[model samples]
Target: MVRSAYERGVTTLTLDSPHNRNALSKGLVAGLRAGLAQAAADDAVRAVLLTHTGNTFCAGADLREGSGSPAELAALLRSIVELPKPVVARVEGHVRAGGTGLLGACDISVAGPGASFAFTEARIGVAPAVISMPLLPRLDARAAARYYLTGERFGAAEAARIGLVTLAAEEGADGGTGASGKGVDALLEPVLDGLRRGSPQGLAESKRLVTAEVLRTFDRDTDSLAELSARLFASDEAREGMTAFLERREPAWVP
Candidate 1:
């Protein structure tokens, strides 16, 4: 599920399905799309803030739910890229596989020390195909190659250094300032304030400038990537990988 709340000039979309660790199940994807659509239509909404409700921002697609449609996933990422208002991601949890694609789609992303990220598709006998549209152009080529190939998980600080996130809040920081002195909210306050101050047209145009290349990538590669994703998910290797993962054992290829 996706929940929404508006404050100042930003509409916050919270991914709230912790059952599957907020995986991209059909219901969750539909909820997110509706939330984004609502934000797009709201004249008062200057930006969108995307965050999640649990320890894992998302654990990629829900393998139990058949992973949804690759084409639909591609469209969802494209919507985030083509959103007229800037989209910001606030992460204080682990992000894996397809979840990392969301970080790439956002205009700006802030992750606290609690946040970690990984392109885990390779470990499951698939490539990070569809996600590469938003990621490849933005990430450090060398780092992308290393992580994508090895399925290595990296923390928020490393994520920032590699351009996977805009900022990594201090380890001492809490998701909100509350009991902690300076934190994730502390890091995001200024940015959100700045967005609130920006003129509607200016913010929209500026967002366009920043997102154009990503949109172009979506246009040029979405079809091919979606095709690749579908093919991979349907393969026997992926079957073994998913089964091994579900059964808590090493896949045959691992030995």
Candidate 2:
């Protein structure tokens, strides 16, 4: 579900499960974690790029699986947070729920004009419990509160404005061929080039400087947050919400 390629000191991990909109299935999560490990071990690799192949960046956790550990996803985010090399999220489509955690964990994220995002857990009768560990540090408090409570979709522009995304690029602004992924490449090149210039130790220490607090919070509360997420996913209310979602009907709790 994840594909990796190395070129010019950068390792790119692409979420390739277009069939599920690259949802964070157990397999996908495992693959991503392994990819991060491989990148960390490689002396030649100076950076990592997280991107996806489908129209949707990631639809979130696979609710159909009905398993709610969220530990694996949390680990993946934590790995990104502690990765010695810089990690960049190259977003070209929508990111939802748990996917937002992946985006937030990245040291830098660039989104195309068409990209969109949302915190959708609340709508499903669950809260963004595990993801909040990373997301809270990346976004504006007020904006985070609004989106986290409302579960509303926001565009790439507003995401940038709120500090969720580092940069927002207009279509073809990267001087690409206007193809599907060229725009992302356009935004990725300069970032990768800049990353390549930094000493490995320098980059690692800089990342540690910035992520120390988030890591501490994540380490302290991850277990409880995962338990909360699992409990909510297994709750009757969330069951009704998931059922209503799949059935294309309003949930019974909706007024």
Give the best candidate by TM-score.
1
- Residue 120 shift from truth in candidate 1, angstroms: 0.7
Q: Model 2, residue 30: displacement in angstroms? A: 0.5
Give candidate 1 regions above 4 Å deviation.
Answer: 172-181
lDDT of 2 at 207: 90
Model 1 agreement with the true structure over 40-147: per-residue lDDT tens digits? 999999999999998999899899965579999998999899888889999999999999998899999998878989998988898899989999989999999999
Question: For candidate 2, lDDT tens digit of each residue in 173-209?
Answer: 5654334444556767778889999999999999999
TM-score of each: 0.95, 0.93
> What is the RMSD, in Å, between candidate 1 and the native fold over all Cα?
2.6
* Candidate 2 TM-score, true structure as reference: 0.93
In model 2, which runs have C-alpha deviations exceeding 4 angstroms? 171-183
What TM-score would candidate 1 get against the native? 0.95
lDDT of 2 at 179: 43
Clash count, candidate 2: 0
Please tell me which predicted candidate would have the highest lDDT against the true structure: 1
